[model samples]
Structure formats: C-alpha cells, structure tokens
Target: MSGLDDVIAAETSLSEVDGLNGRLVICGYRLEDLAGRTDWENVLNLLGGRMLPESAALRERLGMARQRAFAETRWLDDGIAALSITEGLRALMARLPDGEDQETALLLAAAPSVFVPALIRCKRGMAALPPDPALTHAADMLAMLHGRAPRAEAVAALDTYLVTVSDHGLNASTFAARVVASTRAGYTSAVLAAIGALKGPLHGGAPGPVLDMLDAVGSPEKAGRWIGEALTRGERLMGFGHRIYRVRDPRADALKAALARLGAAGDVDRERLALAEAVEREALAQLKVKKPDRPLQTNVEFFTALLLEALGFPREAFTGVFAAGRVSGWLAHAHEQIEGGRLIRPQSRYVGPKAA
Candidate 1:
C-alpha cells in the first residue's frame, strides 16, 4: 500500500484522470471541449452539479464573496507579509468561519484570489487593491495583483488556466481536503488543509523550479546539452514525468496551447515560448534515451511555469497562483465528501518491531 497506489479511496464524479488514454473528463465534458472554449466560472458550476447557464449567477456570487473577503484584509500585518504567499494565505483563511454551505464554498473559492494578491502587494510595500465585483474572477485577480484592468487576451489565458486546473481525480491536495471534510471539520478547514498539502514541493511547488530551469538553459541552442548534463547528474527534470500519467498529461497540452494563444495575441514573449518548446523537446528526447522503461513526458507544470511567468508572476508566487485555480476543485471535493458522510479512517499495517 505504498502511497496508496491503485487504491480506490472514494468515488467521485467531479473529474477523471485517465493516465493510460491521456484524457481528462470533467463532469461529462472532455477537457479540450471546455478548456479554451468556456470560462472558469462555467467549469466551477459544472463541478458543483449546477447547470452551465447558472454560471452567470455563480460568477456574481463569487464576485460578492471576493468583496466580502477583501474587508478582512485589515488583519494583514508585517508578520503575515513576511511569510511565503501560501503561508500568508493560510493565516488569513484561518480567520474565516467554518461552515458547509454553498455560500461558504464560494467564500473559500474566492479567498485565494483576494488574499494572494493582497499578500503580494503587502510584501512589496504597496496598498492592496480592492477587487472589482463587476469583473470576472480571472480578470479581477490579475487586476488586483497589478493594480489595473487586465487586457482581454490575458484575461482569456488566465481563465483557461483556471478552468483547465479546476479539478482532477483525487490529487494529493484534494485527498487532504476530502480527508478533513470527512471529519465534518468545515469547508474552510478542509480548504486550509488542502492548501497546506499543496505547499509541499512534490505537489504544487515544481512550477517555480521549471522557470528556474528555463532561466538556466537560457536559449533553445543550449537545451539539449543542459538537459543531457542534468540527466547525467541524476537530476529529475522539474516538469517532465508524473506519478500516474504513463502518457503525456492532457493538462500539459491544454496549457501549452494557452501559452501559444497568449503568444499569438502578443501578450506573452514569443521567444520565451519558443525556448520552452525547445526545452520540452530536448527533455523528452533525453528522457526517452535515459529512462528507457519509463514514459517520462511533460506535465502541466512545464507550461504552467512559462504561462505564469509571462503573465508577470514571480517564481515564489507560482504555487499561490496554482491555489487560486485549484481552490474551486478543493471546495467541490469537500462538499462531495461531506455529502458522503463517512470519516476517511484507513487501517495501517504494523510493520514495526512486533516483539513486546
């Protein structure tokens, strides 16, 4: 039972990660159908069992929720500002009241967009900008972070990223959230638990390093050499490979396409995207030759690094931005676990010394 590989912890209709076939289905729609075609709000509604038409109302409610969460920024201080963005988020989220209602879910989902930007501003000695309730969620997040309205292409790219990551089958953070929710702790607590789990490097922390790897590689001409040398040193390439996906991760392609679109719209650095693509190719070629048995391919974190970097987020804030998209999934999973009404208590075999 190492790492619960192949274990069916619980049943969920939220999303399915088909690592074998290289497909993702979120609430009956293939990822490709919804990712760039629709907005994150619609995907959020779909995961929550609401009809797509209701996304408009959900958007409005989420907007109001962000406004409400903004008032709590009065508690942000020098101590909180000194912490990492994710930790700062946890500290602020602790102030939220525990509850298991739809309103609480919206609040939990909206909290990251509010708190992350505020924490970034506070860290830089700038005043936190209030969220505009009339703007869409993705737009408002960029707007709040940069203190201006985001351009249309940036909004679409951000929205696509959020939707693409809205949910996946029982990832580490989602499982942590569900475990806490099974205890009836409350949505806020469950979300807090999920955020703590995502803080780990193995889960949500590699995107920043992906950017670092790109910086070190510098140009497409050096990609193969750097990748080969890194392989020789027995180093794990940051964005390639996954625990479950034997094939290329579908989310990776979705994100790569988003980055391409951003480049086409002139909102991102086209040369940077070209460099990333070169790096990806070299990494894939080197991985195939070196690993041989393992199908190590690019994962979501690869393009996630590029896209977020192009969008003006620093490396340290990458995980927090990931949390912004993932919170919706965490809330949905929490509600589902709460509805199931069973504590996620598992038995562990005592392999320690048996003699007494």
Candidate 2:
C-alpha cells in the first residue's frame, strides 16, 4: 500500500514477474512453448481463448480484414507531404470505426499488417506488396511486406516472434490498451492507445537501436570492448536485460531457436547467424565480468534484429512488424478487460506537498 501496489498486486493477471528466478509466464503457458511450436495466429487464438474459426472460416475472415486494413494504407500518400509515418499510422488507425464487437476488433488488430509495411515500402520507393487473401495473418503480413510470399521458414520465424510478444500481461502498452478498453470504447480505440504507448522509446523503441548497435560494432571481436565502453558510460545496453526474465529471456531463446531453424533450412543469411552467435558468446561472457553484482541477459530484441534484418525488413520497420503480430493480443486483452467488467483505473499515493 505504501508504493504503487497496483504495480505489485498478485491479482490483476499482470506482472507475474519473477525477477529473482528470471521467468515470465502469460496465461499459464511458457513463452518458449508458444514461440517454438506455434504460429502467430495460433498463439493469438490461445491468448484470445478462441479457435481461429476452423481454417476455412479464418481464411475468409482474414481475407476480408486484409481488405479493410489495406484500404487504409492510401491515407499515407497524403502524408508524404506532411505527417511522419507514426503520425500517419495514428491517423489511419484512429479512423477505424468504433465498436467493442469481435469483427471490428479483428480489423483493428490487423490494420498495422497492412499500413506500416506499406508506408515503409512507399518511403523507400518500393511498391507495397499486397497480402494474400488466403494466407494466415502472419503469412499474409510477411507476404504484404515482401513481394514473394515468405519462405516457410520466414513465416515460421515471424510466427514465433509474434507468439513471444503477443502479450506479456500488463506490459505498459497493453495496460494502456486496457485503460481505454475499460471505458467501453471500441477495440480500435483500445489498440490506438496501445500503439501510442508502444511508440515511446522507453516502452518499444528497441529493435531499431539494436540494429544500429550491431552496425556500429561491425563484428563479434568488437562486441566486448564496445560493450565495456557502453557500460562505463552507464548506458543500458539496448538488447540486454528486461523488466522480467532474470536468468535469460525465455523469448530470446525461443526466437533464436526459430531463427536457427530458418538457418537450418537456408533461409537466413549464414554470416548474420554467425555474427549473432559470436555476439551472444562475447556479450554473455563480458556481461558477467563487467557487472558482477547484477544479472544482464539478452532479451528478444537482439535476435529480433537479426531475424527481421534477414527477412528483408528495414531496421526502422521492426517495431511495426512487432505491432502487426501483437495487435491480436491487444485486441484479446481489450475484449477480456471489457468482459471481466472492470475499469482499469488505478490510483497513486500522494508523495508530494501533503503538508502544503
């Protein structure tokens, strides 16, 4: 009660944070299991507590949602003269019609799969690839981002990434989403709130800088010295540590294993995989010596950079891809919050000027 007990509450289905043991679980399943064995759509269904409408029904609904989401991409063209990509995305998402219903909720969640990649591709003067009306959500996203349908391996890797991130209970952005949803706002409203929260550097602006760090270091040999300098400057390493995951981020290994499968099948760049392995070894070893008292481990963003980079996505596009997959979880959480019948409003203790 002294501090923000809402932040530390045992009930709220939030922050099952086991910092001492370094483990995170969502909805009673290990992050590793979803990331390793399932596709994004399946994981979404798991978190959402619904089957994906039997394959045929899912494909049909997904096709319709893709059309709805893709049409919004045109708004970005007008933004070429004015607004930034994130702003444009905010604008487009805001325009999604309001409702707490499941149909509109799916559309709200699927919008970024169509919009973000289209905007990024348009900025680079590349034509935006259309999503297949028949593919699963993750597959369609990868197809829409890249002209050729992603290889099976790429789809698998992306699916795992999505599963890893679908929802981590009341992560900052998801909590923002629930806050809006609790107001009986439409699903789009909830997701828009989540997107705004996610756009902040402290919350989700990570993968881009991870790529930048990798580019700056240039090779495995440089990782140790570079990390030492970064530590000396009291800088938080972009890909190291997390609010959860004390021993190692289970998601990191999940995603890494996903990438390894892609490498096994020859979809990922060999050199990139080699570089990541070297960085992993050097980073772990050096982190031990540099911060002897604290535990620092690789989180999802490190391998996420390598995987998304190999998948032909630009570093700037990384978070957008994250959004594409996570929106499902957002929608689910939104729906769950509404069904549970509680406003997400929490209070803070007065810590300033009480006497005054």
Candidate 3:
C-alpha cells in the first residue's frame, strides 16, 4: 500500500477524520459543534474520560505544570541558536523527566507553550519570562511571547486555534506517539517522538510555507499568474491539497471563521485577508482545471497561516505553535495506546526476493 492507504492501524476514540465528506468528529461531537464552543480543558476532559483530572482541576494542574516546565527551559543552550524553533523544542522535551503519570503528561503538554516562546526570546537575546499560573493557557502563552498580558480577543483567537488542532485521526505524528506508547515507554518519550515526526515538512511544516506563497503572490491580481507559473514548473501549491480529504478540510473552515472574526474586530489586516480569499477562489478554480478527477481543495494549512499570522506568530515558529496544541491529543492517544498492552509490531511483506 502506498503510504499505508486505507489501512486500519488502530481504533481510537480521540477524533475521526472523514475525508470523503470533509467532517472532523472529536470524541462524540462534530468539530464545528465543539471547536468554538469549548476550550482545551473541556476537550481534554472528553478525550481522557476518567483518566484525567476534571476540567477545573485540569486547568489548575496544567497551570502548575507550566510553571514546572519553566525549569526545563535551561536546556535552551548556546547550541540552540543554530536550531529551528521546533528543533529547540524537541531537544528540550528530550531533557524532561520521563514518566507516564498524569504529572508527566501535563508537563509534556505544557512544555511546548513554555519552551517555544522562551526559545524565541533567547534567539532575540531577551530574558525568558516566566509563566503566569493564574492565566488561561492561551493567555499565558501569548503573554510569554509578547512580554505582557494578552488582549482578550487575541486570547480567544488562539484558543480557537488550539481547540481546532487539538486532535485528528492517526496522523503521522500522532501515529509516532502511539507507536512509542505501544512499547510501554513513558509519555514524555511518546511526546518527544511525536514532536520529531511533526517537524517534517510534509506534516506540521506547511503552514509557514503557505505564508511564503502569499508573500510571493503579493496581491490578489497577481495570484492567478503566480500560481500558474509555479504549477507549470511542477511546484506543489502549499495550501491547496490534502492527503485524505477529497473536499475542503473542516479545520480550514473553523480557522477561516476565527480569522474573519479577528479581521472584523480590526485585530488583523482585513485587506490582506481579502487578498487571501481571492487567492483561495483562484487556487481552487485552477486546481480543478489541472486535475479534474482529483479534488485538491484548500486544507488546514491555508487558514492556519492566516490565523497564526493574525495572532502575531512569526512564520518560522508556526510549527512550534502547532506542537503546543497537538501535544494534548498526543498525550491522550499515548495513554489510550498504552492501555492496550500490546506492542505495535507490524509485519512487512517481503517482495524483494522469490527465494525459498
């Protein structure tokens, strides 16, 4: 099978990615129904069932975990100056104490928020700020990055981003997390493994490049000509395709909605957003003309770039921001996989030789 196409690797209650119909159902709720209505605390409650703390307690516990994770930021060494944000983050996660307890899981989830902004500050020669245990996860993260308390609307926008990407089906990084969990490894190791997988360009790295594409296009009038020339040279459009979804990605819509609201509130450039909307329409029309049989509609990367940019994150730090949201799902998946008590050892078909 090419890239394990149509293979059922494991059963999960985390989230469902319906590629045919372009719907994402997390736990028992539709993504559209759950994403904007709730925050990460409630999402974790749903995914963890009885394995995690209650929503109120989980918030308090995660706040403490974020403070605990501050100690791990000392691993942001001189060598980290040469590494990407995600690389620095993965290296820091590797140094965390390895364990499978709820403390370990919460720490791993909180570490990304703690480390990502600190590394960015370190790169800029600024002292790393400490987390505010009293703030919400989204608010604390933005405050840490900007060195002040975040605006309420900015916090809301980031909360939506986190909840939207909290979980999906067995994606590359999530599968890596589960495979490590299957070995009965500590949740920290599983989360570390997932971070490594997500660092790849094909997985968690596309959003930043989507920003690059928009920069190249420059204006709405230039979008069609720019995309055409790129396609003629066999360049893959960064945000226009997906691996599974035959229609538009549901996460794309969720994020677009968030951006629209942000734009309406004057938090972002409405003109730039209008240009992106034009690009999306042209890209979809061009994709249809190029590959009629294959649906290459806009995926999550499209709006992820716009939303994160609106949230004031630099393009390079986009993947690290992604890890912050996704670690929640990774911990949940790791815990669930560990309970199965069966190692994920799959058989490989030997087709290289016909010897007996």
Measured against the true structure, the TM-scores of the candidates, in listed sequence, are: 0.97, 0.90, 0.97
lDDT minimum window of 10 residues, candidate 1: 48-57
Going through the candidates in the order shown, the clash numbers are 0, 1, 0
* All-Cα superposition RMSD per candidate: 1.6, 2.7, 1.3
lDDT of 2 by residue, 1-356 (tens): 64243454214442245656756676676676567687766665556554135543655776788788887666666455155556566777887898976678667766887887787778777776767778877778778777776787887787788777777766777878888988998788888898898888777768888878777778877777887787788877778887656688777888788888888998887866666677677777877887877778998888888888877778777777778777876887777788788776667668787674
lDDT (tens digit, per residue) of candidate 1 on 247-339: 999999999898888988888887788788899999998899889999999999998988888888888998898899988789888888988
Q: lDDT per model, in order? A: 0.89, 0.74, 0.88
Candidate 2 Cα lDDT to native: 0.74
| Number of clashes found in candidate 1 | 0
Candidate 2 segments whose C-alpha is farther than 4 A from its true place: 1-19, 50-56, 80-84, 354-356
Local accuracy of candidate 3 as per-residue lDDT tens digits, 149-207: 88888888898899999999999999999999999888988998999999999999989
Return whichever of 1 and 2 wins on lDDT: 1
Candidates 1 and 3 compared by lDDT, better number: 1
